[model samples]
Target: MSTVLPDQLGHFGRFGGRFMPEALIAPLDELTRAWQEAMADPEFTGEFDRMLREYAGVPSLLYDATRLSEAAGARILLKREDLNHTGAHKVRNALGQALLTKRMGKTRVIAETGAGQHGVATATACAYLDLECVVYMGEVDTERQALNVARMKLLGAEVISVKTGSRTLKDAINDALRDWVASVDKTHYILGTAAGAHPFPAMVRDFVRGIGDEARAQSLELLGRLPDAAVASVGGGSNAIGLFAAFIPDAEVKLYGIEPGGDGFETGRHAATISAGQVGVLHGARSFLLQDEDGQTIESHSISAGLDYPGVGPEHAWLADTGRASYRPITDAEAMEAFRLLSRTEGIIPAIESAHAVAGALDIAKELGPEATILVNLSGRGDKDMDTASKWFGLIDAPEAGRE
Candidate 1:
């Protein structure tokens, strides 16, 4: 919980630091200074707070999911971030960075996204702030998350499909960073998650830490104490880190980060970086990454586009190393099953990314027994994932002509 992490150089115990091209140093420095100044300024902070409450719909509900608890064999409370303006926790970081962009006198914002929630959030922020926006998304993700892509377009943001590399989150980041290197003068690259270099890991966490902040107070009010565990799905780890931040000081509150186990560990197609990856540098940070023997980044697979990244935020890497938090993988099948279960039981269709955490929490609930309470960050809704969910669940099958 100390501010010491990310040191003066942005390294989180040899995990985070600028690994970008030299050309980016000046802009990164500028952004860091701007963020610091904004954080220290009451007007900036006040406006940001106002926007979160009035616009992004912060202080999201912490609902007690009684039905879900019965299914999991443990008390369950869900921090419902899915009800945010852009339908995901990504909106917090997007709005924060967008405000910083304006404060820095930048007129344009460029971002990269997977599953398209971040892109949609960025586009929404840009529209609200009257700034130009551009989003880079993987070709595969654009197809799977078409609804979000359409939302971004309707918000007046330009969406570019990056077809390079694995055509996923990592590759989209590659193209976004490339764009930033050339447009740093008039543009700000709103890195979607907490991964990237230096300030991003720290700054994005600060922006989204509201999740944990609210959840902590709500838990005390509702449950009369902290939950036994804080749970969330981790890809670039923004939501997980946000939810874990406020609980870090509570030694009794365990943290669980669920990574995507796409097809299972033996298949080598999962994105369970912290659980199975080797330490390596990727996307400008040293973290646990899925890579080959030759040190090439491996292509990560997941039923959920948002949880399909190959590397995690460096802070998560540090947490895993320090054993302050536990990281595990929930296979795609397990995640999908949870996804279906939540929809049927509670009428809450979670984003497949969040389903990973749901699946993990169920197992943890059983392990900890019925007396324990588990808080899960329901990071986003499944509206944007209808296409993928329909395909996965076979919900689009042809109906009988006279069935009605």
Candidate 2:
């Protein structure tokens, strides 16, 4: 199918643009040109495909969820991104960008991460390519996602804890951007998701489009046709975009992006950008942003560190506005419940971020009923969330008596 989006100037309607410091404009344009040239080169794409197969583990499984399907009253199928090399879909973009960095003759790679999956993936890629790696993470996130931080460090990345702003993902981005500005000549900022400046939203999405490409073919091969719905969790929205890209022209396939509803959007405690946000510029892209009356970005909260963000990808905002796709809020309680349900029913412990999609699929499945088939992107594994999960489910005793 033909695709028509993110027009010549890198806009998904009015949502995406080069809204950044003047200094970043030239670099972004250069990167965009390089990416376009590489995409057109058969040898470049061929090598990328080879790396995906030999290293990053492309073509992840599409598992049929028998018990979960019965519970949801629909045929639930999971696109198992969690089974990838670094236990998440983030590796796809990481390896792709790492190769691009090498092609551009950059020596070091830098990145910012929330739950640390992207940091781990970037670090892993740098290690594989023998490049220097640096990862910036929010101080709060570092504490909660300690395992992933250790994993990044183990992979030889120098992890920096940003103690600014809300001490979360946004702050990490701020610091990473500053680092990139100073070290652009030798460093490549591996923007983790499908957000940020012009090329980033497009570049990262293209790098990871394999998710949708594979799932589309796999669905037809295994189920005789495409799925009725495609559901995935959205923070910066890379995974969701990657899964949505291949089906954009399939009018029969519905797309749903699950945002972190946290306590509730009503309480002003969630990261439900599309559901409760306005068009504003943040982290370069003009998209649905959680902000105040004066347009200052509000701090986003979510039990899942990965979903704690105030802005979404520009393409998602365009998709919502154009009525081509929909976005829904999934609260922490609902996400955790779905997390446990999947573990119990399918013996799969999905990351809390992915649980949002699982919960959303369950909700959608109810309306669609048994005849419809739902495909949910199981974005990552829950191994890194054992501590948080243990606390939430009371699986372990508190450190101090009556701590709560």
Top candidate, metric TM-score = 2
State model 1's lDDT: 0.93
TM-score of each: 0.97, 0.98
lDDT of 1 by residue, 66-86 (tens): 999998999999999999988
Off by over 4 Å in 2: 400-404
Clashes per model (N, Cα, C within 3 A): 0, 0
Candidate 2: worst 10 consecutive residues by lDDT? Answer: 395-404
lDDT of 2 at 85: 95
List, residue by residue over 1-404, the lDDT tens digit for candidate 2.
Answer: 33667887779988998788888888888888888999899988999999999887788999999999999999999999999999999999999999999988999999999999999999999999999999999999999999999999999999999999999999999999999988998989999999998889989999999999999999999999999999999988999999999999999999999999999878889999999999999999899999999999999989999999999999999999998899999999999999999999999999999999999999999988889999999999999987888888878776732211
- Model 1 residue 268 lDDT? 91
Q: Rate the local accuracy (lDDT) of all candidates.
A: 0.93, 0.93
